[model samples]
Target: MEIYNNHKRLYIAALLLFLALTLYAALIPAYKAQNDNAPLPNSKPLSEQEALGKAVFVKEGCVACHTQQVRNVEMDKFWGERPSVASDYARNKRPDIWRNTANLMGSERTGPDLTNIGKRQPGKEWHLIHLFQPRSVVAQSIMPAYPWLFEIKERAAAADVTVQVPEEYRKNIKGDIVATEDALNLVAYLQSLKQVSLPDGRPVPKFLYPKQSTPDLKGMGTQTEDAGLDGASLYAANCQACHQQNGEGLPGAFPALKGSSIVTDADPKALITVIMKGYNGRVKEGFAEMPPIGVNNNLKPEEITAIINHERTSWGNNASKVTVDEVKAVLAEIGK
Candidate 1:
């Protein structure tokens, strides 16, 4: 009994010592990051609505699944920001939740990484729609709906709430009730999850607006055969039937074309290549991307070119067109 007691005492003492060291190490830097950088976000502070949404995030125990800090490795490999430092956590926090505490880690990426998830594709309405009913916009999304966030109103109350969709994006909000202020706040909080740049220990700009320049295509894809076709039209004809006209792409398969920055970026080459040669990525980011649909026996190079130009230019964008020549060049480069 005495021997066992001695062993138990030693084990407890060692465990306590280890915990004390880990906490001291982790908390110091965390505290410093928060205190140092504090509330001086490149963007504005949280609004009343956003604050409320944050509370919802907490009450929902989102922490159990996700982490705010972007660990260095995660930031580099997965494109997440480095781990949340003390300065990052410190600030004009009202509740000071975990002010002096340090406990942040991930159980699994059961849900997509929330780090910098806000403004993921701009257009606040998209977030509201997705939150209200993810499967409506994302065929394979695993995230649960937060319909409680909305009030379910009849008829569009605000111009902002009524998003422009294809005549075919038929699955409208089930109930007429629209989203409420709290729902808006949650959306706002979500939009606030932006990529923060801390250059030389001084944080850089974090904005809801895209930091990079967007293109502006005016008269590009007006080909004789493909003339007058908008992005929606092209998407429906060439891409949508497979990717879904609404951009809800098949799960574990084809990806959504709508709201894809790749489709919107100024670089028409990538857009052209993706459309022409098709793409392949691990199932993790949305499944191994499918083979190029345009390169198949069904579509022609000119049609692919017209479709790419339309998608990029029609989505409230100003991108240059992918000339048939450019599409040709891509095919040649791919040895197709």
Candidate 2:
């Protein structure tokens, strides 16, 4: 009886030991992953203005609509060049008041992911106008306008940044809409939300997930024929965000491509020059200058010609097609 009792106690001890080992085995990898993926050394620290802007962003509930995380999935290719990794968000710090001062990986994506917004859209002027009234920039955008962040002035001061609201939306306002400091701060914060690249020599970590089966499709064999890249498609991809689909840009914001003398110019050099180097000169008062698209976007000569040809052809304008060699010549002549 004594031997049997001792044997039973030994069995219980062994079972407990086995259970503890199993738990440790399950948790050690997670802890190691957290330790291995430290934030990059050159990760940008937010400025005072940007920190304040982050407070405003939280206060305004912008996180409710926008997600900062770029998940690893085939469908998320549009959000960023690669799926977001742990290190990408390692630098993010939450507000001081929260006990969990670590992550702001939003719960849902009512708006587009902002992980690479700084690189994707670097135009401060565009951000200002969009913040003042999203509908003016994106015709079908469901974003709520934050008009309170702006003030109506009879004429904008030299120091004030004027936001170009469309006439239809500005009918009630008496003067130019100037962005407040808060608005500027918010823009700064938005610009700071860039995803830094992983450190050198570090391979992207693979996330383990359950295997998913391909979905059933009824008409896989009847898919439409492939349409090769065209000038129109090129324009739609690059220029339509500002110039708009109809080529009628928002009045006083982006100049309209439709019937514009620049688009229909006999000498394509000027257009090529603008494409190679961004136009930032104020052609008219109370309007923002155009940023150099070619250098900023790194558009190749062939791509520039395609965009120029598309802009000239679309919107009922008749202009000679620009060749790749012509674009190259202009780019060299202008020293771009």
Candidate 3:
């Protein structure tokens, strides 16, 4: 009764209880995690610029919409090659003494998971344009544009990294859009978000409730006769994001395939070459470089033919369809 009535004793007991709870709940767990989970061998610490970008990402509330973790679920498989493990984030450290922002594995994936976005979309130009205006690239993107991360300059200097905003989005602004240092830094940090490959002989975690399989035509060649391959479906899966469903691409940002000279050309070499090696020649014309889709996506000859045929035939195009043999020959000739 005396101990309870004494203010000093009551305060001392409360302080001790708080200390014990903190030590057991926070300090002990943190210490165990630090000791038990070593960073993957291939994972490197973030560079200075990337660190700054990370701060900007947090400041911009990107964590609210985007998640960095890929769960061990079939649906999450699109975000990463393998299910994320603890060691995937082991290289993360506290930003500073004032902030414990080491774990940014956000919940609620309003936006697509960015666990392996670096590998999925590695184009700086794409990121720049997307940042300036999300709708420029993805017509249906619900993400907010971060226009403050860029500046409008009358004429960009040689040192300036300019974003080629589509004319529709830039109609009000009379100057070229240049990426600010923070924007570049943010892109750098985003580009650095690649999933590290596990060491050889390591048992990779499998995604649960595996979806029924379709034949993977990435590495192997499919029959020349289409063989149940739907060209429209292939185009939707691989090309629709840029070229769009109607084949009219976003003006100034992506070239339209509808009535395109390359798509309708009698010779298929140029078209196949562009698909395999990619095209950067249109940069001056405000078009971002097309990534080497055939190579990067590991598209087989039949798949490439399907995409090409779809482009050549659809959207009022009357060009002759390309065969798998022609595509294979071209791929071999180009050494792709």
Candidate 4:
């Protein structure tokens, strides 16, 4: 009886060991196959600056909290997409970052999924502020403050805004460079996000971004409020070539106007000024500056207002419109 029991125990252990080896052998290739693609779902062409930021991201241990991969489950919930392919990161990348398997899949979602976060907000200013003071915009954000990332410096009161460097943080009168140049690299990287819906036949509109909408016509369309219609139309004609029909702007180059406090919720005076004066100076990533459109004296005021109204209402934001008189004031302020 004792001999028979020992033999039975040995047989059971051997069977279990065999099954475990089979499972491991099966999963090993599957893991290699997925990781073989490296940096999955990241399709954008990365510039040198973006690549620098990516290195920082890896070094900063941000990968532990935030993930770049979008799983089938996660991709569908956030913005409907699919499992990533290895080829997405092949260009401008080495050692392929296809990380959907180990660090990303098993990690906790402490921070938001970074798969499409690059352009979620668009402007560098917004990122600067959030980094400067997290609670300022997102009340409950747990992300660490990165004030060291900004450079604070004194800037001259130039009607030409080029004097606004450490341009990432402070606007208007500059103080000191708040964040380091490295910060801007990360901002550039984050602003690179784009939606995958474009792969299909569906075109996305700026107004259709899935954010809570807010609108109030109670005190809108005054003479000062309606100033940018023609400017808007002009922008639609000339600027849309790069900024795109959607307000989000281009992934890496054009900064967005949708949620730009400068455009949507800031002083109406600034909005008129930018349209009539046509802004220069880099707002986001590129060293390339915006050419002035305010040079068109022949344009009508009401038309500019219509454009501003469309933009304010187009993005999921609600605000009063700029009027003709307001445009004139901004025009006068800029001496145009």
Using TM-score, give the best candidate's number: 3
lDDT sort, best first: 3, 2, 1, 4
Angstrom error of the Cα, residue 195, model 2: value is: 2.9
Clashing residue pairs in candidate 2 (N, C-alpha, C atoms within 3 angstroms): 278-292
Better of 2 and 4 by lDDT: 2
RMSD of each: 13.3, 8.6, 4.6, 12.5
State every prediction's TM-score relative to the real structure: 0.48, 0.68, 0.78, 0.42
TM-score of 1: 0.48
Write model 4 residue lDDT over 4-33, tens digit each, in one string: 579888788889999888778887776576
- Pick by TM-score: 1 or 3, better one: 3
Q: Model 2, range 1-336, lDDT digits (tens) per residue?
A: 464679888888889989888778866876687777788765787899988888778778888999888777745645665678777766666566544535567888988888877755666777898898887777768999998999888999899988877787776888889999889999998888776666788786443452453343345553121112276776765677677788998676677889988888977888777665657665464444565666545565666777888888888999877665666677888897
Better model by TM-score, 2 or 3?
Answer: 3
Candidate 3 whole-model C-alpha lDDT, 0 to 1: 0.85
- Model 3: CA > 4 A from native: 1-7, 214-237, 246-309, 318-336
Off by over 4 Å in 4: 1-42, 71-76, 79-106, 156-174, 195-336
For residues 171-276, write the lDDT of model 3, one tens digit per residue.
6999779999999999999989988889999999988997665565555664455445689988886777777788998776678999999999998999999888
Better of 1 and 4 by TM-score: 1
Regions of candidate 1 where Cα sits further than 4 Å from its true position:
1-44, 74-86, 92-107, 156-175, 200-336
